[model samples]
Target: MMKAGPSQEEIRRHNLGALLRFVHVRGPASRAILAENLGLNRSTIMALTSDLTAAGLVREELPRTPGRRAGRPSLVVRPESTRVYVLAFDVGVDRLTVARVGLGGVILDRREAARGRVAASGGASGAADPNEMVNALAAAARSLVRKAGDEATCVGAALAFPGIVRRSDDQVMFGPNLDVGGMAIGEVLSRRLGLGVPVAVCNDANLGAIAEHERGAGVGVNDLIYLHGDVGVGGGIITGGRLLGGEDGYGGEIGHMVVNPGGRRCACGSRGCLEAEVGERTLLDLAGRQESPDVPGREAVRAVVDAAARGDVVARDALHRVGTWLGRGVADLVNIFNPGMVIFGGTLRDVYLGAAAQIRSEVATGALAASRERVKLRTAALGDDTTLVGAAEFAFADVLADPVQVLARLRGAPASAPVP
Candidate 1:
């Protein structure tokens, strides 16, 4: 007997989702454009748009730029940014951000807090206490949600954590920066918020890469590498327009790659790791700045950059040394991945802009000539919001994957009940 094929209803739902996703990613587009892009007839596109509009996932508006000699302006379809939202969280070693983002990657509202990297006993380590971090994050999330008002429908929540997150469950496998290893972060945050929605935890750098690829420096580039810096360095790799997450989602831990043998101790209990050699702490220490709560991590990095700009020999020399190490790491990555672009984000953006010459020199010397000649090095265009935007994109994954079913579930659920 022949196998059964998908029902017509299934096909319609799939087409609806495809249209919604295209509009969401590519921005508001006309029905004619949508029909042409999706290879559907005008009638099919019209039906899909009607269904989506009735579902409240999208809105049809007159085009902002109408064509000349137009009779009636064609309506453009756009994601309903005000009504539907997603909670995006970024957990860094010294910073925490929570944002309410709308369907079309619009940031509706946001809240941010600076976290102290001291142990409960006031030790000088840069690792955040797990309990304290989680509590603070929960509080921030609550505040953001409350501020978003009850009328908004939250589709999902995604957290960008600076660590190796287990794919099986959103567990923190190893986080030298946040000190939250072996914790079920997603489950805890989900229960705390009581939103009844999926709370996803992903590597911070991976999210940064996603945000950059979609809207920032990597926009038009298929193969790219994103390197993020906070208390420790992390990397995100993208190949062929897809995130290259390894088995169990622990792939982009480039910070832990051994660069120098027996150089400095790393939080991962390894000696001479890339992060150990060139992370924020090392850069500050080399620049002769004392680590203290009085100076925030971002501020300290800024101080170094400022000093370098003022021609401070100590700061300039320190940045040069760090840049050389950073370049060595980049050279290895270039040889391995042969990416078309490499984006330096977070604190690394400052470092790269400050020491671009040294970094370029090392890459030119160490990387393969062919790969080096074709690659472009750029700073993150999204500035500090790259990871936060990435978190928003991550939250939208479920909604985009099965738009019809997910929206149906949302519409059917009680208004008082959080999205499940």
Candidate 2:
């Protein structure tokens, strides 16, 4: 038997989601702009906007611009930023960040702390103690939620994890730096936070690409690569305006891409991986700081770059070598993907800033002319918050997709969910 088409109610829900997503990403937009962009008639747009407005997801207002045009002004539809929010968690190698991100892509509050590397007992270095980690994250998230107070609604929570996450279930497949692999961190954190929302977990690099594409330097550029550096390197690739998540959601493991045969051993036990060559340890080792305890956070990477800027030969040379390797790896990706932009983020942002010349030179020599011609290399515009913002976007996905129903579900949540 043939499947039936979508009912009118389903279509309305879709349109509602589309309209909300547009306004959420593009900020306040006029009804006419919404109608034009959504390919909906003016009356339909008005109806949709009215529904969202009544649902407290959006509100219509006069245009902020002064002076009238030839026709009646299209009222602007604005997301209810203050009233709606999500908890965005960024689990980096050096630190953990939790944020209260409002509906209109605004981060209203956040808590960040230096988080030392974790090592699960009786397991390979990457296996995690889920309970301990969740307790820590919950402690910070508690303060954030408390600050949000009673007026706001937290619709969901999302985490940007550094390692490979099994997309189907948000399972951490490998993250040696945090020892979080093979743990149900999402479910654990949800239980700890007791927020009554499923905590969504995804690869950090993928989220970084999403944030940059939507709100950072990659804006307006569809095909782009975002390379993030933490304890190790990670990547998020976007192509034709969509994330290139291969089957099983493990496609963009660019860090493990073998860049140098028989070179340094990677954390994944692979030899000569891009991450092994250009990651934090390699940079510090090249700069002669390998003997020291792994300095917490990006401080170690930033210190090297700072020294390089101060004319320290060792530091400068370290940056140049790492940047070259980074460039070579980038060139290979560029050749394969032919992206319009390549964004350097996390510790890579500092590395890119210090050795931009060397990185550019390597890219020039290694990449095909046609492919390299228009590719823009730049640091993440969101600075330290790229992945954090992306986490918020992920958390907000359900609400943006089906505003009315999502709100209904959230509203239906038991009021006895316990007080903060």
RMSD of 1: 2.5
Q: List the residue pairs that clash in candidate 2.
A: none
TM-score attained by model 2:
0.93
Each candidate: what lDDT? 0.87, 0.87
Best by TM-score: 1
Could you give me the TM-score of model 1 versus the true structure? 0.94
lDDT of 2 by residue, 1-420 (tens): 999999999999999999999988999998878888999999999899899988889988877785456877767899999889999999886677889999989999888876555432333332145555676688888888888887778888999998988889989888766665467989878877776788999999999999999999999999999999988899999999999889988878899999999999888888999999999889988999852333674888899999999999999999999988988998999899999999999999999989898888988999999999999998999999999999999899999788898888877786445323
Task: Mark the regions of model 2 whose C-alpha exceeds 4 Å error after superposition.
Answer: 1-3, 63-74, 118-129, 290-294, 415-420
Candidate 1 lDDT over residue span 77-101, tens digit each: 9999887888999987777898999
* Residue 119 of model 2, lDDT score: 31
